[model samples]
Structure formats: structure tokens, C-alpha cells
Target: MGELANCPNCGELFVKGAQTVCQNCFKEEEAKFEIVYDFIKKKKNRTATMNEVSEATEVEKKLIQKWLRQKRIQPGSFPNLTYECERCDTQIYEGRLCLDCAETLQKDLQQTDQPKTLKEREDENKREKVYYNVDKENKWRS
Candidate 1:
């Protein structure tokens, strides 16, 4: 079923579809994509960073980041292009986090998952559980 939604870019009502924005906004974005894509597709501009691409193409950094996240602009083809890590502000070509943050997070998770002491395991086993009797009519008695 289609639902009504407001366009995030222009704040206009539109039928909700696979597109995040309305048709007008989507068309505008396609035009912008062409501009940005053409600017970075040149051999000399293959090494341009995200910031440099945004500046040279006059496109918003957020839009370029969106394109990267959508895989419309592949980082593998452009060595210097990168987006910020989700956990840290460091630039990364792929995944949500850089190597250092991912390793730190993994270490923290491993430390939290250490084996429980014998006493702790015993305490968990000793936790109370209650049982209730039910009448023949299938109703709770207690």
C-alpha cells in the first residue's frame, strides 16, 4: 500500500515510494549527481577527497556521502574518496568504522563476554522461580 509522506528536501506531500524524496527533488538530485559524477570521473580528479569533490562540483557533502552509502559512487574506483566512520570522525573507505575503532569495540565486547565466575553461575542458578496450580477448568488457582 502506498502512503503519503512529506518530501524531506522541499517539504511537499508525496506518495511514499522507494525514493526518499519527491519526484521533483529526485530529478534535481539526478542533475546534481551528473555534475558531481562528471567532476570526479576525470583521471586527474580520481584522487580527490570527498571535501574536494563537493567543493569542485558545488554539491553538498551530505549528498555525496549519501551517494557513497548507496554505492552509486564506489570508493574502490577512487582511492582518496572516503566517508567518516560511524563511531569516529576518521575517514574510512568502507564499513561503518575504521580499523582502530572496530578493534577497540571488538575488544570491549570480548571483555564483557568473559566467562562468569563459579560463584556468579551458582547465584544465577539459585534465582527464585514460582509455580502456580491450575484448576481442571483451565483457570489459574494460585
Candidate 2:
């Protein structure tokens, strides 16, 4: 069972499932989203930037940015659509983190994996030494 919590927007008690806001706030956001979506979808507004969309639709820039980050509105179609990277706040068209942050994370993971590779090499060397000793012992016994 989900925990009962006050809506972040309205401060009213609502069974929060897919949305953090109450039903009222959720409906309001939907209306706002539709307005923004409509404005952006128009052929003339296809090249509109984030600021232009927000100004024209009277919708909050952050709200539109949320949609962009969620990929609810694809950057490919919008062309100028962008949102802050979670790590460095660099504007990016797609994904949570920017290319630099992602590359840094990849490098960090590779470094973490290096120790395991070194351990494996050490284990292999030990195995080879053991086999050599065993072969020598067997030859002596023979």
C-alpha cells in the first residue's frame, strides 16, 4: 500500500500514484502541458526556443523543461529544445547527464574495473607457478 501524503502543489490529501500533485494540480498541469504542446507543435512555432515557448504559452519554463528532460517532447523534433544536465547543468537536448559528465562516469567505472583485472592477472600468475611446481614434483617422483 502507498503512504498517504499531502500534495506538493495544493497541500491537499491525495492518493499519490503516478503524480506527486493532487488531482486538481494534476489536471491544471495537464491543461498547461496541452497549451505548451499545441504552441510548439504548430508549423510556425516548430523552431521556437524554450524561452519563446514559455513566453507565448504563459507556461513556466521549468515545467516545459521537465517535459523535455522526460523525453515527452523529443529534442530531435523541437531542434532548440534543451534542459540542464543533472550533473553540471550544461544544456543538452537529450539524456539526464551531459556528454562530459557521462564520460567522467564511464572513466570512473573503468578505473573501478581495473583493480579486478589486476587481481585476475595475479591469480593467473599464481596458477601458473603452482602448475610449474606440480610438474617439477611429478618429474622428481618419476
Candidate 3:
């Protein structure tokens, strides 16, 4: 069962599902996306940059950036199409962040999901042993 939600774009109450916005807004976005796609697919504009395409299509830069992140724009065909990395703001052809940022993020994640080995649990259980000499005064009481 879907819950009622106020569309973020139009504030109209809508059944929440895969879409964040209402039907009207979704249709508008689809139309805008088609316009952007048609503009970029033109042979003369195939190699155009994001800003160039945005200016020509008269669409918001963020909307085009969203398409790039969604992988709707192919870098192989449009080599100049690039989006900013979410972390470092570096130009990347795909994904939310660049490769370097992604690696650092992975390293920062704690490995609590990994199970402890038998040797590791045993080491934690062992305590340091101490030896006491009762015959310290008697030098060679072997």
C-alpha cells in the first residue's frame, strides 16, 4: 500500500511510490528530458559540454546533471559530457563520486560484518602470566 505524500515539486498530495513528484510534474520532467536528449543527440552537438547543452536546450543545469548521473548520457558518444563529483567536485563521466573518493569511502566503512577467527578470540581470552620468586634471598636454591 502506498502512503500519501505531498509532491516535492508541486506540493500536491500523491501516492508515494517510485516517483517523488505528482503525475503532472513527472510528465513535465519527461518532456524536458526528451527535449534535452534530442538537443544532445544532434550530430553537431554530440561533443558539446554540459553548459553548452544546457544553454541550447534552456533546461536547468541540475536536471541535465541528474541525467548524466542516471547514465542516460553516454560518455562514449558524448566525450565532453561530464558531471561534478559529489565529494571532491572533480569532473567525472559517471557515478555520484569519482574513483578516488569512492575508494576512500570504502576504506572508512567498518568491517563489523566480518566474523572473528578462532585464534583472534583465543588471543583475547589469554592473560599475561607473572612468576614470583619465594627464595629470592637464597641465591642458588635450585
- By TM-score, how accurate is candidate 3? 0.72
Clashing pairs in 2: none
Window of ten residues with lowest summed lDDT in model 3: 127-136
Shift in Å, residue 49, candidate 3: 1.0
Query: Residue 106 deviation, candidate 1, in Å?
Result: 3.7
TM-score of each: 0.74, 0.73, 0.72
TM-score of 2: 0.73
User: TM-score rank, highest first?
Assistant: 1, 2, 3
Worst 10 residues of 1 by lDDT: 123-132
The parts of candidate 3 lying over 4 Å away from their true place are 110-142
Candidate 3 local lDDT, 1-142, one digit each (tens) = 7889999888999999977789998899899999988988899999999899889989888878877777777777888888899999999898888999998888766465466899977787674444545585765442
CA-lDDT, candidates in order? 0.91, 0.85, 0.84
RMSD of 3: 9.7
lDDT (Cα, 0-100) at 99 in candidate 2: 96
Candidate 3 Cα deviation (angstroms), residue 90: 0.6
Better of 1 and 3 by lDDT: 1
User: Which candidate leads in TM-score?
Assistant: 1
1 or 3: which has the higher TM-score? 1
